[model samples]
Target: MKKSYSIEEINSYLNGELIGTTTHLIEGPEQLQAAKSHHISFIGSIKYAKYWAASKACAAIVNDNLTMEPIDNKAIIKVKNADLAMAKVLELFNPPAPEFTIDIHPTAVIHDTAIIGKGCKIGANCYVGKDVELGDNVILYPNVCVFDETVIGENTVVWSGTVIRERCIIGSHCIFHTNVSIGADGFGYRPSEDGRGLVKIPQIGNVIIGHYVEIGANSCVDRAKFSSTIIGDGCKIDNLVQIAHNSVMGRFCIMAGHSGLAGSVTLGDGVIIGGSASIKDHTTIHSGATVGAGSGVVGDVEAGKTVLGYPAQDARDMLKQWVAMRQFMKKQ
Candidate 1:
C-alpha cells in the first residue's frame, strides 16, 4: 500500500523551511521531470531551475540558494542541502521490509555442531557447515552456504547464491548480495619443479568483514595466503568488484562496479575508487584519495589527491595531456 504524508510532516522531518500550502498530501518522491500531483521532487542546483516551473509535483525540495517562481497548489520545502533532504523524504516512502520467518527450514542442511542464535532465519536449501556460528537475527536466504567454522554476527543478511567460505568472520549488520563469494581462494601460483606447469599455493587464510559493510551482487573477496583479508566498518563495495588476497580496506571506503584491488593492496580510510578502475598489487591508496573511472593505478596514490587515466596521475595533469594530444591530432 502506498503511504502519504502531509507537507507539514515532511517539512518537520527534514527540518526544512516550508512555503505555500502545508496541507498537501505527498505520496512519494520522483524526479523533477516525472513528478506528478501528490509526488515530491527536488532541485539541487540552478541548472535544474527551469524544471521547477514545469514540474507537476504538489511539493518540491529546494536548496536554500535556489530562487524560483512558485506555482499554485504546490508547496516548497527549502533546505540547506536539497540532495540530503530528499534522501530523508524518500525513506518516508520506502516499501515495507520483507517478512522472514525466524526458523530453520526443513530443506536446510545445518550441521549438529553449528550454533544458530535467536531469531535467525535459515532458508530452504541453505547449508550451514560444521562449527559455524550465526548470531541473532541473521538471515540466510535459500541456496546460501556458510562453510565450516565461519562466524556471522547479528542482523547480517546473506542473499541466495552467496557463499561464505571456511573461517571467515563477518560482523554485525553486514549485507552480502546475491552471488557474492567471500573467502574464495586467491590467485597464487608458482613455477613447477620442471617448469612444465604452474603449482597452486594453498590459501590458508580467511576474510574479515567489519560491521555495517555491504558488498553488492557478484563481487568476490579472495582469501589470503597467510593473514586475513580485511574490509573495515561501513565499506560499500559495488557489483562485480574484486578484492584480492591480503588486501586491507580502511573504514568507509567506496569501490564502484568492476573496480579491483590486486593482492596485498591497502586502502586508507574514505578512499573512493571509480567504476572499472584497477589498482595493481601491493599499492597503497591513501586516505581521502579519489581514483577516476577506467584508470590503471600502478603506484601509491597520495592522500586527498584525485587521479585519472591509464597509469593514473593527477587529474589536472591528465586533462592537460588529453588536450595536448587532441591539438596534435588536429594538426596532423
Candidate 2:
C-alpha cells in the first residue's frame, strides 16, 4: 500500500526548504505532466519548470537552482538536486525482494565433488557439476546450470534459466539475471581445404567476471579461443547484449540494451555503449568514450570522445555533416 505523508514530513526527510502550505498530504510521486492533485512531482531544471504551470500536482520537489517560486495553494520542497532526491524518495517506497529459503531444493542435482558454501540456496532442477565451487550466500534459482570446474564467489545470485559453462570464474556480489549465458563457444570457423563446409575453432578458454557486475537477461558472454574473456568490476550490461570472445571490458563500463562488442574488442574504464551500438572486431574504445545509440564503431575511439552514427565519428563532426547536407539539399 502507498503511504501518505504531510508536506512538512517530506521536506524534513529531504532536508529541503519548504514553500507555501505544509498541511497538504502527498500520496506518492509521479511525473510532472501526469501528476494529480494528490501526487507529488519534481522539477529538476529550468527546462522542466514550464510544465509546472499546467501540472495539477499539489506539491513538487524542485531543484534549489531552478527559478521556481512559491504558489498560492501548492507546496514546494527545494533541494540541492531534484533527481538524487527523487531516488531517495523512490527508495522510501521500494517494495521487499522475493524471499528464498536457505536450503538446497530436493530436485537440485549436485555432484559429489561440488563444494556448496554456507547459507547457499540452490533451487529446484538446478545442476551443479563436479568440482564446482560456490562461495558463501550464493543463490542459484530454479533450472540454472553450472558446468564442471566453475568457481562462483560469495553472495552471487544466478537467476532462473541461466547457464555457466565449464571453468568460468565469477566474482563476489554479482547478479546474473534470467537466461544469461556465460562462457559459450566463440563464433569462430574456417573453410576446410577438402571442399568440406567449415571447421570450428576450439574455444579452450573461460570467462572471468569481476565483483559487483550485473548482467541483464538474455545477454551472452562467449569464451575466448585462447585466454579468458574478461568483464571487470562494476560493469553493467543491459538485456540482449553480446560480449564476443576475447573481449575485455574495464571497470564500471556500461553497455545498454542490444549493444554488442565483436571478438577481441577492448573497452577502457567508464566507456558507455548506447543502445544498439556495435563495436567492430579488434576495436579499442578508450576510457570515458561514449558511443551514441545505434552507432556502428569500425575503428578505435580516443579517450573522452563521443562518437555517433554508423562508421562512428566524433559527434560534433557528424552533426556538422548533417547540417551541410541539409543546406545542400535546400539549394537543389
Candidate 3:
C-alpha cells in the first residue's frame, strides 16, 4: 500500500480545511462504489460533485466555494484548488520509485567506451553502445537499448525495450516508459533523380529532452535534420505520441495519447494537444492554446484559442460543423 495521510494533513498541505483522515488508498468514482474507511477521494469539478451524495469515501479534497449537501460519513477537505490538492496528494503517495543499486546485470553488454555514472542500474539484456553517458542513479530497465553518444542525465529511468539513439540529451529526473525511442531518423525521404526511387535525407541532429519530463510507453520522438528536436521542461507526453524532427514544444506543454506532430511544428508554453490530435508540419500553436481530440491542425493557432476537426480551425467552426452534421444525419 502507498503512504496514507489524514484529511487534516492533506488540507494543511493544500491550505484547505480538513474534516477527517483516510489511509493511503484511493480510486476514481467509476472504480469504487463506496470508499473504504481508508479511502481518499477527490471532488473538484462540478461533474464529479454529483457523485458526492453516493460517495462512501472517508475523505475528499474539494473547492472552497462549493457547498454540496454533505454526506453523512464523508469528510470534506475544502481547498482553494482541488486539482492542486490532488497533485500534492499524488506526489506524497506516489513518490518516485526507489533507486536500485548501481550494478550492471550479467546479461547486459556495455561497450568499452560507455560512461555509466555512479549508482546507475543497467538491467538484464540491456545494451549500452559506445560513448553513451548515463548520469547518476539512472535506471535502464530490462532489455533497454541505448545507442552511441547518448547523454541521459541524473535520476532518469528508461523502461524496458526503450531505444535512445546517438547524441540525444535527456535532462534530469525524467521518466521514459517501455519502447520509447528518441532521436530516431525523421521522415525526411525525398524523391531521387530517378522518380522510381526514394532518397534518404540524413537526419544529422539530436533530440533534447528537458528536466522532469515524463514520456509514456511506445512514444517516438525523431531527430532533426540540422538542429535539435526539443521537448521542454515539465512536459508530460502520453503513450504512442510521435514528435517529428525539428519540433519545439514549450514548457509545460501536454500531449495526450496518440497525438502526432509533423516536422517543424511549434507548440508554445501551456499548449495542450488532446488525444489523437495530429498537427501538420510548420504549424504554430500559441501559448495557452488547446487542440481538441482528433484535430488536424494545419494553420497557426492564436493564444488561448481551442481548435478542432480536420484542417483544424477554431472550436466555434468545429461546433458549427458538428451541428450541421448532426442535423444532416437526422434529416436522412
TM-score of each: 0.96, 0.92, 0.88
Clashes of each: 0, 0, 1
**Model 1 lDDT on a 0 to 1 scale:** 0.94
What tens digits encode model 3's per-residue C-alpha lDDT throughout 1-332?
54655556666777777664445444322212466656777777787877766666777778887875545556778888887877877777665664545478899999999998998999889999999999999999989999999899999989998999988999999999989999999989888897999999999999999999999999999999988999999999999999999999999999999999999999999999999999999989999999999989989999999988888888998899999999999999
Q: What is the C-alpha lDDT profile of model 1 across 1-332, one tens digit per residue?
A: 87999988998999988888735688999998998897899989999888887888888899999886567888888999999998898788888766666478899999999999999999989999999999999999899999999999999999999999999999999999999999999999999999999999999999999999999999999999989999999999999999999999999999999999999999999999999999999999999999999999999999999999999999999999999999999999
**Stretches of candidate 2 above 4 Å error?**
1-4, 21-27
* Best by the TM-score measure: 1
**Pairs that collide, model 2:** none
RMSD of 1: 1.4
Which of candidates 2 and 3 is the stronger one according to lDDT?
A: 2
Q: What's the C-alpha lDDT at position 33 in model 3?
A: 49
Q: How accurate locally, in lDDT, is each candidate? A: 0.94, 0.94, 0.86
Per residue, candidate 2 scores C-alpha lDDT tens digits across 64-126 of 988787676788889999999988887776776557664899999999999999999999999
Ordered list by lDDT, greatest first: 1, 2, 3
